[model samples]
Target: DACETRVPLVLCGNKVDLRDCGGRRGGVASEAGERLARDTGATYFETSCKNGDGVVDALIQLARQMVTTEDVAVQTSALRVCAADQKRPCCGGGGRKDV
Candidate 1:
């Protein structure tokens, strides 16, 4: 499942340094990653921290997108679930406690 939001979403596949690190580096294919980005309406980026590939470029792209769409409304789940749980008129909010 994918998280849906009215915000600029950038999907990054990191640790790409393992791509050529022998057979122990099996991971998601690039074609599938691109398909997922298309399906989710997000920008895709393949980054390798070791070599710093696509790191700055991806950040710049996301920053540019955020700047251009700054007016979009963001629906944060903290506000969503808390609003639904408040039974009183002046309830502050509800927080989740992991068991």
Candidate 2:
């Protein structure tokens, strides 16, 4: 028998800080990322490893999605994990607050 489970997917655009720096532009456009995410049924997020922007939010959203994919009891446990993560700093000492 073939397993029919669908895993949650998230598409992250890293190094977003360099996307628009000084007079230079790089990295994939937000529209493109969103479009790809939509086409693949995945979530899109722009992140900056240097600044930690969108890091926590993406992680939390992934956790929430994972929770929803699980059974009720497992969902509850996973939600707790997400909630606890929100209390900590994003990436531990990145100084960015979690949402």
Candidate 3:
């Protein structure tokens, strides 16, 4: 059966290291990212590819959200059950039953 699911969201601001380079302004502020995240109901993260900051943290948070989501749990359970059923022999017989 098809079901509706609310997927978790994450807003990532990349290249945060650039913001600190030579005192030159870079991308949007962290506060702006946070505000957008709040408005969109998503988790916010700032990552720098050069320094590898917050990259793992963001991935971890996203993974946590995905595993903890209700719909994912339900779907996983259903798939397990289906797999178990598929393992059962047809006509309630295991292998070829001797007549």
Candidate 4:
């Protein structure tokens, strides 16, 4: 639940490539998947790992949802945190200064 509150979530229905090849019924319908996504407050994706379809698109969509212009605006609105002894910034070259 903590992760849900802190991060954007995507509902992916993988293995779409096998929906028609074997002697098996198709998976959930697109309408059903969309309804599920609406109910869960998450983006839905029908991906096929076999042919690499919808994989990159889903990843890009999730990333865009997580990193938004609003978040950047809020971050830039706040005053920069300055360490007492540090010359540059809080996380600016702190670990790589010795390297």
Best by lDDT: 3
Q: Each model's TM-score?
A: 0.60, 0.65, 0.65, 0.59
- Which residue pairs in model 1 clash with each other? none
Clashes of each: 0, 0, 0, 0
- The TM-score measured for candidate 4 stands at 0.59
Question: Which consecutive 10 residues in model 4 have the weakest lDDT in total?
Answer: 77-86
Pairs in steric clash, model 3 = none
The residue ranges of model 4 lying beyond 4 angstroms of the native Cα positions read 1-6, 69-73, 76-99
lDDT (tens digit, per residue) of candidate 4 on 1-99: 223244577888777777787677655567778899988888999988878988898999999987874476456545344333445755765566554
Tell me the whole-model lDDT of each prediction, alpha carbons only. Answer: 0.76, 0.84, 0.85, 0.73
Task: Report residue 61 deviation for candidate 2 (angstroms).
Answer: 0.6
Q: How accurate is candidate 1 locally (lDDT)?
A: 0.76
Q: Which candidate do you rate higher for lDDT, 1 or 4?
A: 1
Ranking by lDDT: 3, 2, 1, 4
For model 2, which pairs clash?
A: none
**TM match of model 1 to true structure:** 0.60
Candidate 1 Cα errors over 4 Å, as ranges: 1-5, 71-99
Q: How many backbone clashes does candidate 1 have?
A: 0
